[model samples]
Target: MSPGPGADSAPAPKPHDDDHTSGTAPGDGPAGRGTFSSLGIRNYRLFFTGAIVSNTGTWMARITQDWLVLTLTGSAAAVGITTALQFLPMLLFGLYGGVIADRCPKRLLLLFSQGALGLCGLTLAVLTLSGEVRVWHVYLVAFLLGMVTVVDNPTRQSFVSEMVGPEQLRNAVSLNSANFQSARLVGPAVAGVLITAVGSGWAFLLNGLSFLAPIIGLLLMRPAELHRTEPVPRGKGQLKEGLKYVAGRPELIWPIVLVGFVGTFAFNFPIWLTAFADKVFHAGAGTYGLLNTLIAAGSLAGALLAARRGSSRLRMLLGAAALLGVLEIAAALAPSFWLFAALLVAIGMVGLTVNVTANSSVQMATDPAMRGRVMSLYMMVFVGGTPLGAPVVGWLTDHYGVRVGMATGGAVAVIAAVVIGLILLRAGGMRLKLDLRRGHRHVRMVPRERLTAVV
Candidate 1:
């Protein structure tokens, strides 16, 4: 189950690595720690450029949507419902989505998904601009958008191989995380200003426009240069097979399990943040922008830190989870909005670090042929837990208060980390060995206990 370590390959920037048509250079080349080059293919530059533009816009839409709902009805439960509708499809159809991902052309799938998402954005924009937006309309659109995301995420993940080839895959995944986090920094602030100025509706309109970047990249990509996975026709046992493949690997299992809990609990920061600003923080939309920007500032640092460590190790992942847990706890207890925002910066940094580590580690360890299935499982756990867990947090916030709900979530995250650390060390037959003399290269190895799901 433990795919081999990706230590031999340095993650690189896409543009730098793509031009070398010759096969991988044998070991002595200076390895990159954090750029688009990891995949040895340079074209990821185009991919990265497009993604950077798109992701920031997406974040803007998300914050605006949440803020709008809070404005319209003042119902936290409704926000929970909106969030749940968006994510519930992943729990229901994510595995099948994975099966399709392994078989589909990722670029084409992305095109269709992006198109659908853009249309939804446009619809939302029109509704908002007309001053006719309704809670029910938002709910329905959220569900539709979620459906598109279910298709988009898996295809996008599996497509990484095509952009950079197998050699730079680990680095590619890590760098991509950095890109996503980087966009996180800019997007919220922009959305905050726009929301407060023109209104939340304009933010949606802009998101619709941002889709152009990726569409352009896709169109411009040289078809002949791509590394495509062969399509697999649907069969009776495909979904089960993908599940069995995941069930077999402890390296994969523990990371996904940990992320499921942590991502689910910690990611509700958006909901908690709006509450904090309105309730405890007593800030307006502008402060909401600052809060988000501050967190992204921490995340940008985290993504950069992750980029340095050449390999994704179990120890780094666990450490991040544990640190983030502490920060989240502090955030919930903060006496002032400024203090809470400061805590959020640290929370975001550690959160992104853990996320990138887990995401890169799992992607690197999975078989190329089964990569889609594994990545789908990873996404499903990370996002699926949101629908399941967010509602509970929302309910807690609605009744007990945002602080209580967030604190509980942080506590749960800490417990999840502790448990995962134990499982990896004991039952998973992993040993912790740290090499501080060098950068943090410590790792857990489980060759003997590894599970093979190909059968």
Candidate 2:
């Protein structure tokens, strides 16, 4: 569930005076509102709108990029390599990016990072359009994109608190996921059509141009309305400070650890889906795109449901993760394409529940002054683990067959969820309780002391 009020050592940062203009003052506006309440804030509304366009483009690029790698090499491992290259920088330098985000103006940092990201996309587009693109060229651009993401991801993540304040942070985070998943529903379908009709290059070109929407949105934001935090002054050992902070808090540490396991071992969908499309189903890029769209549909639904919820619970997080693993395993063994595809939708829903719950819970538990570094470490473990997982999953798919690879990932997720859940229970002096009586709650976690007293 929720962490205690004083979970972090640092005092919570006060909202800027201009935050009142954004309509997020205590007991007013979005404060005690419903699912779409965060959108009532003008600044967040702009950020959300721009994100819709940019995120759609991002999904398009991702689909096109993976397909291009598959087309160029015809090797699943190569696709894994592309994925790995894209996230490797986060593994190496993610904490440092958090430090930068904490020390700088987030809006300014976002401007530069977003511009650099657009440039990276444009460069890739030029290469593809000019017929000069090679696998190495794609790899180069992916790495550069990742370098920017090391800073961009943390800045963007922590910026939500400023836009909406703590009152609406979870709502905004859920809506952000919803926005991305909604784009997922559209981007792949469009990419499929483009790849089939025009070419992957045009998809790449469109993705490059899509960044302009977000850039323009950033410029239009009212800086005075933001709930700004005092930036952490530059200093040595700040990374270590962040690390130590997380280490001491079970609420922050366990969620990050669980997500790390799931992210690294279970979230290799690109590799798994591509292999299933080409090898198992004997299908083409369109099938790949369709499968992605199905997942997005489920994820969007999950995100919307999460937005309506009042709080994030660790029990829900663990249950969703375990369900995701089970669904993945079932999908791996499905005898028909339709059955497998159906399982993917369920997988997407549970997977997103796992993500949104962990993200919101962690953010709610963290101190604002430390959010950048905390979120950076969060993103690093979550996304950075990809480099380690993708190649291994790819190799497994290549040698052991797609079913084995998929099932193995699911098994790892299930194991991680169980292990981490148990660890948390033990640390909290609680135990799982099963009640097999009518008109009673069937299963729950109860404090050991309570159980002893009852006995």
Candidate 3:
């Protein structure tokens, strides 16, 4: 999931400890409570804690789901199909989800969607526990979960601003990434143990139970403390308006487009990891879990850095994307399992940097009124691409080889970075330059007019 970016409002300074209430006073601007500034806001703290619990379960369920499908069917393609079905709703209905997000109260929407997702988890748990679970059953449950996520993702994303406000928006977003990554670190290890000890069914059940924390947190929040924005009015063509809004901003649209490529192709980590573990490395569930844990460790580090950095920038987002692309290629060519695992850490860091920066930048560039729609679009382009890309990558891994699939994704990501970078330079009216000064070479991207005059 992505975070919203820069703001039209200047970020108010960190709030004083002496002036603090249960949270900030109304209209006082967003307060960075401390380094963990967003936590200073009571509402945000509740949301944060609940989110971490839920994210752990979410990650556990993801690993279990893929592993279960592979165990049941003994086919990587089956896992791919499950993955595609899980994200297909985001591709098909993500825009409508965004439209609904704009029109509804996000907290209320989250409560309903979270419950629906829990029910899906419970159902899958029951079916699997019965030993009657089928590939079709997994497929159906995955599709249903995806349907809920279509609404849940954008609502949850847009809700962060209301909890922490614009002042801590970037910090809150980075912390959210950190929170999710932390869950990723813990979830898989636990799931691996559970699967080895008892079964995947228990992992699903735990996930179902995990949703309760967030629901309770949402209920306990003081609604009045929320930094609320007006919901978009019900009207036709609002979707088109959101589309036009993104289309008008080169900075926003280009990163989004780049993410679409990366998300579709490069971000299929679960598939890649699973293939490497089961096939390439001839490893078991334990090794698979370790690989995920390493990536999450790197992701946590990246998220923390992003939080301390305090702002999202366009240049950094692009640079991260390019670096991530290069890292993926290196990992693809890695000869040993340990080397590949090590590369995953760098992959996780660069990948999370790209995600956090792009998410923050998009949110910052958007109008509060239009945030839900824009974020939905951002999610749509980034996550929705998975439905299209996963199965193809899976097929390539199954038939050609895992390295081939990995290389394909990396190559596509690198191409996307170069193309998007060129587009940004052209839009900014600048050109790349290489010069040698005092025997030390420097490459500078300079204005087209300056280059012409110098010539």
Q: Per-candidate RMSD vs. true structure?
A: 8.1, 6.1, 6.5
**Runs with alpha carbons beyond 4 Å of true place in candidate 3:** 1-34, 439-441, 452-455
Cα lDDT tens digits for candidate 2, 1-455: 00112222345433222211111112123352487989999988988998999899888999999999999999998999999999999999999999998888888888888888888888888898898889999999999999999999999998898888777888899999999999999999999999998888888888888888887888888877787777877788899999999898777788899999999989999999999999999988899999999999999999999888776777788888889899999999999999999998898889999999889887877788788999999999999999999999999999999899999999999999899888878776677777767886777777676663222
Tens digits of lDDT, candidate 3, 128-213: 89999998999999999999999998898888888877778888888999999999999999999999999999999999999998
TM-score-based ranking: 2, 3, 1
What TM-score number comes out for model 2?
A: 0.93
In Å, residue 71's CA in model 1 sits off its true spot by 0.3
TM-score of each: 0.87, 0.93, 0.92
lDDT of each: 0.75, 0.85, 0.84
lDDT (C-alpha) at residue 167 in model 2: 77
For TM-score, the strongest prediction is 2
- Runs off by more than 4 Å, candidate 1: 1-30, 34-42, 428-455
Question: For model 3, what is the alpha-carbon lDDT of residue 206?
Answer: 95
Q: Best to worst by lDDT, what's the order?
A: 2, 3, 1
* Prediction 3 global C-alpha lDDT: 0.84
